[model samples]
Target: MPATDVVSWLATAYLSGMNDELLGDIINDVQHQGDTSEAMYAVAPHLLALSQKSSGKMALLMLIHAGLISASSQSQIAVPCPADLATEFQATNNLGRSMVLAQLAHNHEFDDFKYLIAALAGFSGHGRFGRLIEGFDLYQDQFHHALLDTPIDDER
Candidate 1:
């Protein structure tokens, strides 16, 4: 599918309010088996524009997805992003950073605030921290156990 079509669908879904199934479909269309497609880069500007409009769940999801696509393009197994796309992607990342920073400045009460933080980390060029945030759920049990097992120092 063309990037414009994908962006149109995403915009419609965002306007209509997205559910998990729709998010899954969006992810599938943009990234395949953890690999980002050219269309992902192509639609990034649109996604960033939409994300800038709100700090809601759908907007955060779009930012996070764009961040993940940026990360994937840099992975060793992935193809090098085309220079034109890379330039556009970098611009999107800059705008995303500004958006996330503004969101972080506000008192966060939303359930998906952590995802916004992750997007901030990613847009700020800290891919490792971004991945940590994004994958925290996968290791939450182990992390909790580790924290519980750690010895505490009483001396202050």
Candidate 2:
């Protein structure tokens, strides 16, 4: 199976679970996904650059999925952040974190560009060309995030 396929499967699994704690397990995943020379030497810098404006949690995920940006694997080479990518991912809602995680499941495509685009279509209810996120009303209730562990529940 392709990496994207694996990730799409995993994403379905995660969405089925639908909780905040699920975020943490995935957060750890971002920190340790790649450990190759190709990862270390070629990809680390780009990851770091993408993470510049991200929050700590968001940055970590971008780092893990963008390629590699670990201290042990910091490349002397600089990966240029392109000035002309027509698509600009901004974290207006949940950001692109989930989309990035979805990318990791597939080792086939360099990233989950396809899934990200699809999910984004679902999120905002619009395709990259302009179609809105479909099925928005059907699954809009906390996205089932409410089923997750709560602090009040921990008191029990």
Candidate 3:
């Protein structure tokens, strides 16, 4: 499918309240085999637009996916992002950063505030940290147990 078509379908499906499983298809179309396709750059601007005009889970997910795609483009094994696409992606990324900051500033309650912070980290060029934050929930119990078992030293 053409990148534009993919964007259109994604928007329609998202607005129509598609399940995340189906939406994962759109994400997979742009990112597969541990790398992003050129289509990701093309779809990024549209994702940014969606994020801007939407709210809640869908918007945050769009921003995080786009930021992850941009970050993956920097990996040594991945194709180098085109200069033009990089410029456009950076503009979108900056806008996403601003949106996240605005949300944080409002002190709004979020069901997944950690994901929002993760998206912010990715937009700020700390993709690894962002990923770690995103994965924290999966390991929350283990982390808590480890912390409880560890002895703290009061003396330097």
Candidate 4:
């Protein structure tokens, strides 16, 4: 199956109430099969949508965090963060930690961003976004301080 088709299937399966472990297995199977470069771009808009919703944004955050923490085989793709959305994401209260996570993930320069985006859409209505957001809120200050401590290259 094509990567896009697999992504669509995964999204449909998850939204149709598929089990989490099963979804992960499916993702693994797909990743094992071949390259997913096209799928990466295909899923960016979906991630953008998730990032906009209060209900879905936490899932996006979690997926991004997870991808950042663990190494994934899929190639990295930068999902577009529109100017307005970028501003809103920046303005989000207590989201500094999440932003730090995103920056770290981006800097890692590996792992497909689309996978996280798909996972976010797949986890829609899962009710765990609340806990995820709460965790971020609880740790935002520490992450902000950590970010401040790290020196950024002005040249980049």
Candidate 5:
């Protein structure tokens, strides 16, 4: 992707309303068609664009958790969260917050982290039925981090 295209994508993605249907399509593509070499790369720019905001981050994380890409692959293609996001989140609450941040920061393993993603997706941008959008931002990253620390086998 060219720098100009990236800039354009970022603006458009950030400004647009959350599109669950679009996200679902992208997720399906990554989950089903990800084996193809070109598919992931083709979908990466959109995923990268969505990663800029909390709601989009939820979608991006869903892709990661669903085995869309390896950690190294994601690092190569997707945008990294600002370094300060980690530090800032970690400092807020030790055990809970650190675990969430760690999970997201190290989202290479494929596991059943979908519930967390779904929860965020459900409440992202707006609460149930699009009612409460204000406090959603407060728990955004913590929600992002919630499944970050899970062990792939400890499905307890």
Candidate 6:
């Protein structure tokens, strides 16, 4: 991975820990999605790629949603949490396969990896839900913000 991508991942991890209190609402929303495999799946890369093309509010909203989902599912630490995992989608479609990609994108601790992989498994079993999330265009500014927040790494 490029130093920049590593930096981006680091920033998200840092801010999430620091902003934990402020992000309760968003966290819950993401957890809700994680609770259901039918909801968010393993569509990280595609969502990340799609986010780049997003134009405005839709992009921001989706991006935030996507990030939360990534963290929620990927946060292997929360594996003990009960979730309502749905069936996986068939890989017959291109998008469905992409959602599976999200599952493979997590760079979290063991606990996070467990949660994410489980969520991805559930979503993949759902037929096409994972694919649908993959097709969404969420504008994620993590890379930009991560790069900009380089000065604050010491705070972590």
> How many clashes show up per model?
0, 11, 0, 0, 2, 24
lDDT of each: 0.66, 0.34, 0.66, 0.37, 0.36, 0.37
* Segments of candidate 4 deviating more than 4 angstroms: 4-7, 10-19, 22-26, 33-36, 51-62, 65-156
lDDT of 4: 0.37
Q: How would you encode candidate 5's per-residue C-alpha lDDT over 38-90 as one tens digit per residue?
A: 33433444453354344445644533322233221232343443354434322
TM-score of each: 0.68, 0.21, 0.68, 0.28, 0.32, 0.27
Residues 1-156 of candidate 4 have per-residue lDDT tens digits of 366555665476446533445445444543333333333333333333334432333444534432322222122433343354444432322242343345445543222343443333222322133223222211322322222544334454
- Residue 83's lDDT in candidate 4: 55
- Clashing residue pairs in candidate 5, if any? 100-145, 103-148
Query: Residue 4 error for model 3, in Å?
Result: 6.7
The alpha-carbon lDDT assigned to residue 143 of candidate 2 equals 26
CA lDDT of 132 in candidate 1? Answer: 60
Worst 10 residues of 2 by lDDT: 129-138
Residue 95 of model 2: what lDDT?
A: 43
lDDT string for model 1 (98-133, tens) is: 877776776374435666766777677776566566
Candidate 3 TM-score to native: 0.68
Q: Which scores higher on lDDT, 2 or 6?
A: 6
Q: lDDT by residue for model 2 over 1-156, one digit each (tens)?
A: 123433443354334532235433433343343222322222333334445544444554444443322222222342322343212322221343454455446433322343344334423423222112111111322222222442222223
Report the alpha-carbon TM-score of model 4 versus the true structure: 0.28
Put down candidate 6 lDDT per residue, 34-78, tens digits, no spaces: 453322343333333444454343333334445445434434343
- Which portions of model 2 show Cα errors greater than 4 Å? 1-34, 63-70, 74-156
lDDT of 5: 0.36
